[model samples]
Target: MAASDNTPATSGLHQQAVDLLHALTGRADAHFHPGQFEAIEALVENSRRALVVQRTGWGKSAVYFIASLLLRARGRGPTLIVSPLLALMRDQVAAASRAGVCAASISSANATEWSQVLGQLDRDEVDVLLISPERLNNARFREEQLPQLVNRMGLLVVDEAHCISDWGHDFRPDYRRIKDLIRQLPPTVPVLATTATANQRVVHDVQEQLGVGLVESGREPVMTLRGPLARASLRLGVLRLPSNTVRLAWLLEHLGSLEGSGIVYALTISAAEDTAHALREAGYNVEAYTGRTDPADRERLESALKDNQVKALVATSALGMGFDKPDLGFVVHMGAPSSPVAYYQQVGRAGRATERADVLLLPGMEDREIWEYFATASMPTEAKARAVLRELGEAQAPLSVGALEARVDIKRSPLNMLLRVLAVEGAVEQVQGGWQVTGAAWHYDAPRYQRIHQARINEQNAMLDYENKSTCRMQMLVEQLDDPQAAPCGRCDNCAGAWYPTHVSQQAAENATATLKRVGVEIDPRAQWPVGLQRLGVPLKGTIAPGERAAAGRAVARLTDLGWGNRLREIFHTDAQGAPVDQPVDQELGRACVEVLAQWAHDGWSGAGRPAGIVSMPSVHRPQLVQSLAMGLAGAGRLPYLGELALAPGHPGGAGGNGAYQLASVWQKFQITPQLQTALDNMNGAPVLLVDDLVDSRWSLTVAARELRLAGAAAVLPFVLASRG
Candidate 1:
């Protein structure tokens, strides 16, 4: 076990590692796995620049470490390891140190120490360097210092090589830029890249992007692990929530039922806090983590989780980015993730050692909104970002924020933001001296754009397929990933009979039919009858009768407030004292109107045809209308969930506006909280009954009713709000 123990100095591929370990640590035998030896031999036999891919628990790190050791042993040069995660780099350095290797890392956590370490490397006192791509990308740091450092590097190893490819599950533009940095290196210096998982596309991209010949050893044609090992160590579970509050209640219950070190990934910081509170109320140990938490406190919480002092952690994605826990028992997704890859990675964190672990998905309707939001959300144009990067390449040295802003023709704030993102992508490096553009092989051109765009289209098409899927959920999963050969997974919702093909197919068809009916507007049951009304008009809810026309008209009136109508009173109705007044609209109608309004709000009121009054709208129009209407009311302080709303100017019926209105009063006629009651108490105007086109779930309507009654409104009434029969 001594450093001088007999581990024979090997020849050929492993010679560099033996020499480096012997010289740096005086260790004759640093245990190396056979897989590592195979990878090193492949790299030596093939090309200097190569890629090594394997599973996470496998010793992928040892492959490059041994190579670096070998090169240093031969007096080649210092080895540089560019890592994606700072924490992982720290762990590597710690492990190397424990092995008596003079290794150090450069990351945000140890900036000052990095400078000292780099100085030591310059003095020829250090052998190995571990650093994050962000640190290496810093132009000021690179120009003033890194060039000298890299010039001495015997090898440049890109850990997490999958990041180099945009097609990889987690793509960083900075990672795409590393090839240019390598081009600046000495021709004789070798480059080794390693990753845990890379599909064929990823492997191809990594090679092309890095401009290096590949050494693909251990690329098994058949999966080596079959049977029980093929099954995920983490068991995936799903829970359906009736409402947001119910989601909190359920989380609390589950936490109380299952006690151990775990994580609850919630959608929002607020949700995390509320859920943590509920869990604590239920008498369980819990703490919530969010972006707002202080860095020191965050570290403390992580440490506590590691120590098993904290029973559970309720947090957003912000909490777990770089942190790794090998013994984690579970990672509960309290809400649906925006994408499957994100879900997969988060769940993968648990069961690291093939120990049994639980991965839970607490599904809720709110998640549908989250998914829809992602589907429609706008992203920065790839061209715009790429063009900014191109300009960076022209610079002789690192450019300052002010200078880069002018060159990029973007505001300083946005330019800096993009620079950070690009830094993360490994496309550019910022040092104390200036900005340096990297990744020359991955150019911003038409062909690249076409590829990226095609990928986007593929993703969109896949989304549509997922929504329209009629097969088993597991089958759908395999289909989405194009892994048709995947043996039938018997643990998924489909295989477990939680989601049956027949049931889902019927549900999807019914859902589609309802959507069509809502958008088309059929007012009577007869209209819904077979061939009764050819091409149903604006979506009908149940049976719209002549008597409900007034309610419908009343609901339509608020549309203008939601920016749905023009030439209609923007401020409809006044208080009893004859002052200009705006009362809380009914929740159902208000929600529908707000959603429609948001659409027009984006289109500048022209997209909706600049209507002066009620216009036939689709059922899809109703949900967005409600959200917009709610936002407007909330902004005006007229739709308080807790506090009263201030009446519009020149309002009557009260001394300083009617008592503040509760949001509940506007619908159900009850005040749920002081904050909401305060809002309800403030509105001085006559109560406007906001009727919705449909109350499919009736949950929103119920909340609306409670708020309306709590505000002490004169009267609160429901209109034509019906769930799908």
Candidate 2:
């Protein structure tokens, strides 16, 4: 990612003292030192698009804000500030408003107020407009009237520009079309882009994406921010737990002891709810924040957090982005978060103004598995021009996300996100009722997609490989971004030996093996279970009835051309020497199934050993049963059903192990999230398996198996590792 030659600069603009002061005091400009000011000054005077690779503490905001106001004062019309966080828009608008700059931000906070702002903009009553990309795609805003208003606008300032790059730590597809929007803007309006973090490639992408002018300030802000730069004074605590309940208990105890404003980051809505409930039961005022939260309740929670009415906030990543509460004493991660960007932003929620904050990563095996799950499951696609065009073609009117979700069968959130991308690409026209096709063809272009996709993959791979590097982690990141630092960052986990190289290797190996690797066990989709089905020879068509017998068996019959049976026999068979077969599972389906098995061992293992009970499963989804078995083996270091199964005398483990090795008949249940799916793949392609939800004689397993198979899984096995019935 590189900056374009067309970026706008405020080389000779005379900034009003009021605007300059406002920009200076804003949080974006907070904690600026003298040398950083010199860098900012240079960027202000430069006309070319500049790369200000300043560290975290250095007021990176001043570089863009000052430039924006100065450019405006110099008669550059209105500056359209593209911010990453909706919350930040308020802060920016508030600061600008204080400076006598007519500023308005379009966000979920003021959804109805947008029309008023638009009316004002039409009348030329506003100067700087701040908004989130989400806001930009609002059907009401993207209508013909709004695009006309935008055409009347002047400059474009992209804050947190790193989001535009797939290679960036925080990748948001909504930010993809920012470059196009700028290109569509009044041609003379210059683009000013700013971000707290960006590697060389990310910088390149930002420039290319936004069409920014070239200006490079060779300074690091994170390194220049005050004294012990890493906020080393903050007590970094790692609490390892075996279960969510235990983690909740620890959090409750700490919240009681701390008795101060804090944040607890949860991996899911359920976790947040459970944790909040537990905290409330323990007599603490708390609330959880997620996309699912009602707007009013969400507002109340933010207000509570700000006013310190709530002692703690149990939230997801939604709590990040522009949340500026300076008195937080602790930030607790109730679950593991993927990537440093997410971790930094969430932890950075606390410790505003460089205070002594306690940053705790309370990670359990499940939590870690979930984080790993999201990272591995995320599949980055190329910029598909046709997908964009198809969206634009089908859209007749402006469509909101709700409408889009109704049109498509996908979940509302991701579907809305994809719509956002299409909107940004100018492929679809945003309208009041539904989207209108703008007559642009966004067909898939492999070459163009490859460029962006490959760059992103390279960047992530660099970070993944960083754990194995002998150099400091911080240094490795900096150098990967082409910022070659001679000295190691003494404050990071690497410097303190908190992140041991050995640990990284172990984790990577486990992750790789548990993933959909060729070397792992393949799930056979054709392997049918005889328990709940009418007959073994009959293909399951309609549904299974009640009171069926026999056990769940996964079928690999689909890959007849691939000879999946041979691969399975090779995998299950022992050599003449009585050892497990040595031949590698070569077929795709076999490999995929094996990978699922591996995922179960890594991610699904509960560490409680095999659950005790008569494990029963629906006959259809037998692969899930294997997953439970593998997980039990990994967690408890042995099979739980050893003494329970009535098997042949010479059954593989039956010769020596007790009947407990065989799982008692219990139906297995499942729910899949992209995050959970990633964990399953990481655990060896074992999908998320729940044992309690399964009832005797049900079609759920059958449905689950069909869905998994549809999702490219070689098989879906549902075996009971335990039974409560």
lDDT of each residue in 513-625, candidate 1, tens digit only = 33222211111211111111112221223342322221111223221111121112323324578655434345544455455444433554322122221111112234443
Off by over 4 Å in 2: 1-19, 22-48, 51-57, 62-65, 138-154, 185-188, 212-237, 241-246, 256-260, 372-409, 422-619, 622-725
Clash count of each predicted structure = 101, 96
lDDT of 1 at 587: 53
Q: What global local distance difference test value does model 1 have? A: 0.52
lDDT per residue, candidate 2, 1-725, as tens digits? Answer: 11224333333332242236445574333333444444344434443334455444345555556655666656665667778776677656666665457888777778788789878877777778887876566666566545875666555667777788877767787788675575465434455566556666677777676542222333221112211123333445454554444455556555655536888888766457656766676678888787778866876788788888888888878777667666677787875564544555566666655446666676644443454445543432443334434544566556554434323333333455556666666666566566666766565455765665565455445534453455654455445545544257565454664521112233333432222122222221222333212221223433232222112432332211111222333344456887544332234533344444455546443332222222222223244434344445334433222111112233232111111111111112233446434433444433223221122222334545444444333333344221111
Alpha carbon lDDT of residue 601, candidate 2? 49
Task: Report lDDT (CA) for all predictions.
Answer: 0.52, 0.50
Q: Clash number for model 2?
A: 96
**TM-score, every prediction:** 0.57, 0.58
